[model samples]
Target: MLSPEDVQKVATLARLKLSTEELQQVSRQLDGILDYVAVLNEVDVSNVEPMAHVADVANAFREDEVRASLPREESLSNAPKTDGKYFLVPQILETA
Candidate 1:
């Protein structure tokens, strides 16, 4: 079982703000989670093969076909704000 101090340390590391009651509750819950992991660690996997994932799958990406893009005026038509030739967005970075 995790101690109160240990629970407090973990909460601090995780940036959590907990009351005394919540700390006690979390300590018990964390102990249960650790105990469950200990049980899993005891399972034998000597015959099992290591894998990237449990399932075998591959991505099927479509080929890119470069063609004509939307006209500047058409693309800017739906924008909430636009300058004559381009999209007008709020300045995020200041110029040096």
Candidate 2:
């Protein structure tokens, strides 16, 4: 069970301002949460192995293979604006 003072102290550490009513409300809520945790602590899981996931998972990647590249003119044909060899984009940053 968490006392009102304990709740108040936690609120202070978290930089929260609580009225008297709010402090009491939070204290009750904290006590209930602690009670639930205590119930969980009574469960026996000594035989269970720790698992990272509930379902089996595997990497699903396609085999890599080299392929012919698109010609520069064909690739740049649809660009709104481009240099002969590269895409021409608006400058968005300034250097000090």
Candidate 3:
């Protein structure tokens, strides 16, 4: 069972602000979750094979191929702001 203090600690780590009532409720919920996990821990899996995924999944990625790209003028045509040679974006940093 999770104590209120334990819930508070977890909330603090997660940077969550919970009221007293919420803390109590979350404590009970966490306790229940832990209890369910404990029950699952008791299941026999010694004969089961370990696997990354339940389904037989395989990567279906195509091989990368070199290709010509769109011209610079055409590429910059969709930009909200550009200086003909480059995309013009807001200056985010200032020299100290």
Candidate 4:
């Protein structure tokens, strides 16, 4: 069970300003959470393997392969600004 002082100390560390009523309410809530955790601690899981997730997970991406790409002219056709060979973006950095 968490005392009101314990909850107040945590609130102070977290920079939370709780009224006296709020402090008492939070203390009771935290104590209930701790009690639930204590109940969970009693469960036996010695044979269970630790895992990152419960479901079996696999890579969902398509296989990577070299493929044909759009021709340069077609790729550059939709650009708002472009030179003959490359896209022309506005200069953002000041040079030394």
Each model's lDDT: 0.88, 0.88, 0.89, 0.89
lDDT of 1 by residue, 1-96 (tens): 888999999899999999999998888888888998898777899998878775656776887988899888898899998886888889999999
Cα error, candidate 1, residue 1 (Å)? 1.4
Flag the better candidate by lDDT, 1 or 3.
3
Q: Hey, what RMSD does candidate 2 come out at? A: 11.9
Per-residue lDDT tens digits for candidate 2, residues 1-96, read 777778889999999999999999889888888887788777798998988777776776876998789999999999999987899998879877
Preferred candidate (TM-score higher): 3 or 4? 3
Q: Write the per-residue lDDT of candidate 3 for residues 1-96, one digit (tens) a residue.
A: 777788899999999999999999888888888887898777899888878876776987887998899999999999999999899999889979
Which model is ahead, 1 or 2, in terms of TM-score?
A: 1
**Which ten contiguous residues of candidate 2 have the minimum total lDDT?**
54-63
Segments in model 3 whose C-alpha atoms lie over 4 Å from true places: 46-96
User: Higher TM-score: candidate 1 or 4?
Assistant: 1
Candidates by lDDT, descending order:
3, 4, 1, 2
Model 1, residue 78: C-alpha shift (Å): 23
Task: List the candidates' TM-scores in order.
Answer: 0.45, 0.43, 0.46, 0.44
| Candidate 2 similarity to native, TM-score | 0.43
Could you give me the TM-score of model 3 versus the true structure?
0.46
Give the Å error, residue 6, model 1: 0.6
- Output the better candidate (2/3) by lDDT: 3
Where does candidate 2 clash, by residue pair?
none
- Output the number of the TM-score-best candidate: 3
